[model samples]
Target chain A: MLYLVGLGLHDEKDVTVRGMEAIKGSERVYLEAYTSILGVGKERLEAFYGKEVVVADRDMVEMDSDEILRDADKVDVAFLVVGDPFGATTHSDLLLRADALSVPYTVIHNASVMNAVGALGLALYNYGQTVSIPFFTDSWRPDSWLERVRENLRLGLHTLCLLDIKVKEQSEENLARGRKIFEPPRYMSVPCAISQLLSLLEEEGQTPAEASSDDAVALNPATTLAISASRVGAPSQRFVSGTLEELSKLDEEAFGGPLHSFVIVGRRFHALERDFAVRWAVDKDNWNQVSNGVYKVRD
Target chain B: MLYLVGLGLHDEKDVTVRGMEAIKGSERVYLEAYTSILGVGKERLEAFYGKEVVVADRDMVEMDSDEILRDADKVDVAFLVVGDPFGATTHSDLLLRADALSVPYTVIHNASVMNAVGALGLALYNYGQTVSIPFFTDSWRPDSWLERVRENLRLGLHTLCLLDIKVKEQSEENLARGRKIFEPPRYMSVPCAISQLLSLLEEEGQTPAEASSDDAVALNPATTLAISASRVGAPSQRFVSGTLEELSKLDEEAFGGPLHSFVIVGRRFHALERDFAVRWAVDKDNWNQVSNGVYKVRD
Candidate 1:
């Protein structure tokens, strides 16, 4: 049987009781590395599962998925992922391969970052389309995500911006030249993302449009945001709040490390949520005022 | 300290180890019952956590949040949710109340249905504005979600249609007279959702537009979907595959029980993903034939 288990956002312990059981019972365990990295390293997962785990990079999964499924058909092979088994489409490919090989499979689900964004106190239902803010290169800055955010704003829905994380990604030149060089994994910070959004809005001449809408009245340079940093499921989980402009101004020391994401508040806000944002306020910069009763309307 | 923990989908075992610890350590544990419910009931969670849990209904939370946050300043208190703590905006209000009471708060995140739709082998980055298809009433067959879905289709982005769930909802007469009459919690099924979608499309006269748009290829009844039913994190978890049209024909027996949701596949499927879908084909019906290759491009 092939088992796909989600390790969740943090360290080894973040795996659900069921996921741990599947990992422990498997004869061979492989961790899909490129799609996403766990807050903790492979060593920690190995120690917790009490089994050696082979790291499966993009090459191993894409170029040699057949072999992985072949082995699983004979013995229980567990492929562990950072989030839920199907969190990324790549993992679904693995499951499809297992099914093609006539191998019995079981998927053990766990928390993934997709839903974890709710930590910012936004209603999941009220959230519109989620867009990923990629790290901008000197020559390439995609404003495609701007249209999505605009639509969500128009619908009075919150937008969950998943920051980009590039791991084991090869440069165009390196890939064309048949070199094995890879850029370092990058996890976009919330502040950097907001700055990019502001820049894109200005570029598209939508700065005024973004600012003038009643839904976007709370957003500005000094507008507050709930930024979550650190490994969520890890021991050192951290969350901070500040305006978009102030968040960009603060140094990395305030956020403390990798895998950070941001939430852009929408027009509506529940009284409790507004108070929650106030606790994470950036001192005197309080341009983003949540209205009196935002949660009164039921979705 | 106040802790908001996500129980994830499904049963008690679905709770992350960190969430379990928090629940065990808390002096008082309150489970929010309005937003969503687990596969099992209060007794199951109480048995698993080895602690007495109080059901914080909507009225209790809206009217008497202070009672739950009263001693949070002194001792640890946990508010358990079906998905992530922030999945529903109500918990954010609870946190704000805690902040107002000067209670240090922490959120233990978990996966909610928001992103779990990626299980269908669709790229998370390509999903556009999500819409909620509410259960239609005699006088209120809302079609607002249709416009949002149509907009998403125009942009070649996937639409995550979150089916509505009605829990402890009152009848009009009961609400008008202020009575305690309540109906059974209702979870929107895939069939009902599709029927509504098709009817709304017909009403809008966008059937041909939706059916023949080269740009809106991702929006189709035959588009691949992850039809998941039952408690995802529970032992009885069940997931199936089919087009919206095909899925709408499935009976309750095959779909299992409550808390069912689906994901509509978007364009831009990876080559590896296209090959994977071929293996999940049931009988003579192929998902690929239904929803032509949205991934094919001349680049």
Candidate 2:
């Protein structure tokens, strides 16, 4: 049996008891490391599980999944993912491969940012299609995500923007020289994502999608309310809500570390939602001033 | 400290190791039993954790929360919630009360249907605002959820319909008599939900929301495709896909038991999603005919 176990967000203890039992009974365990990272290291997990764990990078899992599923029909093999097993499409692809090979598998679900973002006091059901924001380069900057956010905003739905994490990436120079050297890991911070979004809105304002239409409105950084969540599901997690313009100028130290997420508040906020969110406001007085006019139906 | 720990979906073993540790160290443990339920009972969880577990019903949680948190500030109290602590806004309210009382608390995240629904092969990011379907009565039938579904369908996004479960509910007669008598637990099955939806659509067709034009359309049961999932995150879980008409006529026995979820498939479908869905089709040939015409792209 091939068991796709989820190491829920945070440290080693986040793994469910059932997941731990599966790990104990498994002959071989492989941890997928590229998609997301745990708060603790592999050694800590090894110490807890008391089993040797093989770290599987993107190349190994995407290219040589057969090795991961080898002899699964005869023995229990555990494949661990940082978040929920199906959080990423790649893991679903792996499940399809297992099905093709006639290898029975089971998924152990855990909390992922897809759901954990609810910790910021936003109702999960009020969120629309989630979008990912990739790091923008000097020459290549994509604005497809802006359209998604726009659609969600138009529908009065919150938008969860999953900031990108570039792990084990190679520099252009190293790639050109055929060198295996990799660059340092980079995780998009809240300010960086806000800056990219601001730039995209500015560009869109200059060149409207349709020339015939003069009502092509852009997202206002000064009035758009957003919540910046850092290290969610961790002990030191922090959530702060404010306008995009106010949040964009926030100190880098405000957000402790990696794994930051942003939520663009929609126009329709329930009184309870607004109340809960105000408690996490970066500047309580400013938030009250902006939210009084922004959020619908004051309590 | 007050700890809001999630006992993930499914059985007692679904609780995280950290949750188990908290339970072990907690002086008093209260399980919130109204929002959602686990496959196992309180006794099973009690046996697993070797601790006494108190079940908190809607009344206790909504009305008597202060009593639950009376000594929590000075003692280690665990308020256990099925799925993630933040899955329901009520729990967030409880956290707010804890904050008001100056009680430090920690949240232990676990899998909720919000994320576990991804096991059905649909991309989580493609899902729009989720809606809940309540048991329809002669006078209390609501079609507000239909608008949410329509919005999602218009955007080509999947709609996750959370079926309502009535636990420890009192009848109007019993309530009027001021009796403590409770009705048997009622879980909304897939067939019942479809019937309600179809009836609502039929009613909408007869009397349109506004008589401004005749172009206001309603969902066609015969052509709509949906996926019925039962006991998700459990070992005996099942997922079946078929046209809404066929699914509506399906026997209740086919769905097994309680905790069923329905997903109304949108217009857009990636080939991978189509292929994965077709694997669980009630009628493979019919599914192909319907999906081929329904899914936007072949690839």
TM-scores for all predictions: 0.84, 0.95
Model 1, TM vs. native = 0.84
In candidate 1, stretches whose alpha carbon ends up further than 4 angstroms from where it belongs are A136-158, A166-187, A190-243, A265-275, A283-285, A289-299, B172-181, B202-243, B265-286, B293-299
What class would a CAPRI assessor give candidate 2's docking? Answer: medium
lDDT, model 2? 0.85
Can you write out model 1's per-residue Cα lDDT over A143-256, one digit (the tens) per residue? Answer: 777767766665566677777889988999999999999998888776678788778756656454455655353344544344444455555666666556767777766777
lDDT of 2 by residue, B106-173 (tens): 98999998888888888888888999999998789987888898888777788999999999999999
**Which lDDT value does model 2 have at B182?**
98
Interface RMSD of 1: 2.7
Question: Given candidate 1, what's the lDDT at residue B15?
Answer: 81
Residue A45 in candidate 1 has what lDDT? Answer: 80
The candidate maximizing TM-score is 2
lDDT of 2 at B87: 81
Q: What DockQ do the predictions score, one after another?
A: 0.48, 0.67
